[model samples]
Target chain A: MEERIEISILLDFYGELLTDKQKNIMKMYYNEDLSLAEIAELNNISRQAIHDLIKRCYKQLLAYEEKLNLMKKSFEQKKIKNEILEELHKLNHQSEAVIDEQRIKKIEQLVKTAM
Target chain B: MEERIEISILLDFYGELLTDKQKNIMKMYYNEDLSLAEIAELNNISRQAIHDLIKRCYKQLLAYEEKLNLMKKSFEQKKIKNEILEELHKLNHQSEAVIDEQRIKKIEQLVKTAM
Candidate 1:
């Protein structure tokens, strides 16, 4: 799961950097689960071209992930933020704390704006 | 970030369930960033067909994600497991307790076998 998140972060950051053909090849093979021959026939390209595109896409994805470490840091920051939000929600729900519905609504509005 | 992970797992699981045409349409549009007319021309299909297929694909993807919630639970479980492993590694690093390198090696082997 950790690896998946890390991979995803790298994917998102470098996604714009990917060529249309390379991205299409990855989507066809990994996301769509299409066979190489199927992708080749569909796109009117050679099977070897599809194969090579996929390989290059994977290599680029890994390289960006390894060099930037963008995803891991982003995930950690998100995790912490979520934890703090949950605690805030919990506090709002507690009966002992002078429950202020108006304040809660205001806080929710602020959160929405920030998001 | 969380949404991306959730979307990814749902994408993976629902990806296996998508029809070839629907999946291909999604790939050409979202991942490939191709215009509808371009996809239609390339696939030798009508533009309307491509548009309809993409709409249906989005509907199915959302339905699968909402119903399954597979990604959310999986993410939580992974988070817990990783925290435990990190703690284990930290303990292994500290010499405060009688460190058993042999036991650690044995545990690593067991973990590999389990994986």
Candidate 2:
């Protein structure tokens, strides 16, 4: 489960760096949870070839992440954003009487739009 | 100025999609503001070839944007995030008496970390 999440995040950052064929194969294998034999039959390739291709794609994705660090930066940014949102929520709940309601609503709207 | 900003945003989204040579050429032309002849001399290529390569890279970057819209989405998200931050700053100032000071500081910290 953890590995799947990691791959999905990597794919989000570097999927466009892959060829069309590799992209489709990765989508099938990772997103659709298709087995190697199924992907092979769908693409009219040998099972071993499908396996190799998936392995190559995974390696490439990891290599791209290593060099670019986009995924790492994105994850850190998301964590911070979530933390800010949590603080806002707490403020809204605790200071409902004293805080301006309209301003709180506007902040909520902006956060929702950003999400 | 606007064109340079657009190119930089597009490059951020799709630069890794380019080959190493193409990426270097693009950085020289767009980011470094190098003329075609200057880039050509730096890379040991003809001036016309350098121009053509930069054009090709621009086209590819735009094509990637058209297909993916990652840069557009990113820009919109940033705008919304900025709006939220503005609202938070306003809240911090206006509600200084009622709102929890620590929470405001925490939100500011998170936003700064995210940025």
Candidate 3:
């Protein structure tokens, strides 16, 4: 339970910031729970460099998560966007007059592009 | 102009993820353009440690930035929020029928809280 909880929080925190390579490495090591040597062999990096990069990346990633607070801020932004979208959807349904479908579409475009 | 251009880019990039301490150091060094020894004396850290920390921090910050693309993503998110807010503002004003002032207010609250 504790492990699951920790992992969820960490994934929620640093998941977005991870490079594809880093993410793959983390998935292998943490999720698939592969050993460092095995991961290094698979990735074709020296085991020592893998160890150093992973350790350093992990530390920096945690620090970035802490300093950036991206996850919390991003979650809040999404919640707001969803709420506004919901309200707008209701409004679009209510009006007998033509909703500015173009404008609404543009707004949706903006939201989608950003997210 | 070139100098300004670079600072703007760098600040826009790493401006959010830096520690308050790191931010201060950066501002002092880059903006005020102080030497490391001056910064060290002011912050009361050893020159060597300051040098090491700053060098390491700069590398890590640049890597975090390159890998995460935080600046680009965050700017896009803000632009979307602003567009949505503009659209919502237009709606609030256009409605002759009872605008859900409370709902609008709540949405505004959400945007304000997030941004």
Best by lDDT: 2
TM-score of each: 0.39, 0.71, 0.52
Q: Write out fnat for all predictions, comma-separated.
A: 0.00, 0.22, 0.24
lDDT of each residue in A1-115, candidate 1, tens digit only: 6544544455565565576777666766766678999999999999998888877887777875565454554565455445435534543455554434343344334333322
Residue B32 in model 2: lDDT? 85
Candidates' C-alpha lDDT = 0.59, 0.75, 0.64
Tens digit of per-residue lDDT, candidate 2, span B15-66: 8878999988998888889888889998999999988988888988888777
Encode model 3's per-residue lDDT on B1-115: one tens digit a residue.
3643445466656766777787778777767878989999999999898888767666766676576676556666576567556656665456564545454555445444434
lDDT of 1 at A3: 44
Assess candidate 3 and give its lDDT: 0.64
Error of 1 at B17 (Å): 37
Positional deviation of A93 in candidate 2, in angstroms? Answer: 3.6
- Model 2, position A108, has a per-residue lDDT of 53
Q: Residues B1-115, candidate 1: write the lDDT tens digits.
A: 6543444445664565576777777776766678999999999999998888877777777775565444554565455445435434543455554444443344344323222
Candidate 3 lDDT tens digits, A1-115: 3643444456555766777787677667666777999999999999988788677666765676566666656666677566555645565555564445454455455454434
Answer with 2 or 3, whichever has the higher TM-score. 2
Show where candidate 3 strays beyond 4 Å. Answer: A1-23, A31-60, A94-115, B1-22, B30-61, B93-115
Off by over 4 Å in 2: A16-20, A95-115, B16-21, B93-115
